[model samples]
Target: MEDPNPCERAKKWLQSLQKIENMNKIDPREAPISLDSSNIYEGFVFRGLQIDQLQEGRALCTFKVPPRLVDGNGIWPARVIMSLVDNVCAAAIMTCDKPVKVSVDYNLSYFSTAKTHDEIEIDARVLGHKGGLSTVVVDMRNKITGQLVAQARQSMHNLGGLTVTPRSKM
Candidate 1:
């Protein structure tokens, strides 16, 4: 059954994420497999992501660049970096007491290269909200050297008074 209260749903989702973060090793047999693009991307990008802190309108996370995400030059690809920024920003936005919003505008800047096995720290914070739009900024930095890797600013639009239903299985 679907939870009617968005807050409760959000809380449950966050708790599940926290639980996953605390696990030392995830059993492959217990892992869920889905054809959903969002789930697939999340599973791939967040395999080594660790949630260090979470609060209202803020999130701090750490991730190690995996080999699968590296390009031929042995550095993180732009798409991977962008995906990390977008997902982290969305996680920060989810900390707020509002329904999930869809990204309408996303601006990203890459500053440095990240190689495989490089640890990156991610910090995301909600800038503000206007009417149905919320803005957030995410910063990625080298955990060891503190060099900035990338930054992203995204604006998300909330669909007020709209009921969103899940797509049924075909």
Candidate 2:
């Protein structure tokens, strides 16, 4: 007999959550993110990212630095950290079913480097939101020594289902 797929199970759980009419009233942390990209791009970029825990506007995100993502010096690049931070920021500010938001402004500060095979944990929190914009802060730390690796402050604008400009095909 074949063992059941955990990914399939997770999708089913997310589906059940979507069925609830009061999904927005439920604690945002309680929502399980789906892995399907057709449903959301956050899931696609965060394919291997894990949400260890969350509360209110804060989330604990974990990711492993794969060998393929390392730069020439065998360290993860700042751009990678920025991408992860942006996603984590979105996760911190929005709940399931909330309209997707795009990063309008983002900034990063690197305190250290992460080598291939390093396990990283990010603490992301939504600082505030006004009108159509939300401000988020994230601190990336090494899970092993708990040293700070990078930090980011991002501003996002809620697009509210408005179509986005598509990137030109290469």
**Per-prediction TM-score, please?**
0.76, 0.67
* Alpha-carbon lDDT, every model: 0.76, 0.69
Q: List pairs with backbone clashes in candidate 1.
A: none
Q: Write the per-residue lDDT of candidate 1 for residues 1-170, one digit (tens) a residue.
A: 76444334444454343233222344546544333456555566666777788778887888899898899989999888887777677767777876667888999999999999999999899999899998999999999999999999999888886877889999
* Model 2, residue 146: C-alpha shift (Å): 1.7
Q: Give me the runs in candidate 1 sitting further than 4 Å from their true place.
A: 1-34, 161-170
lDDT value for candidate 1?
Answer: 0.76
Model 2, position 80: C-alpha lDDT score: 69
Q: Provide the lowest-lDDT 10-residue window in model 1.
A: 15-24
Number of clashing residue pairs in every model?
A: 0, 0
Residue pairs in steric clash, candidate 2? none
lDDT of 2 at 38: 31
CA RMSD of all predictions: 6.5, 11.0
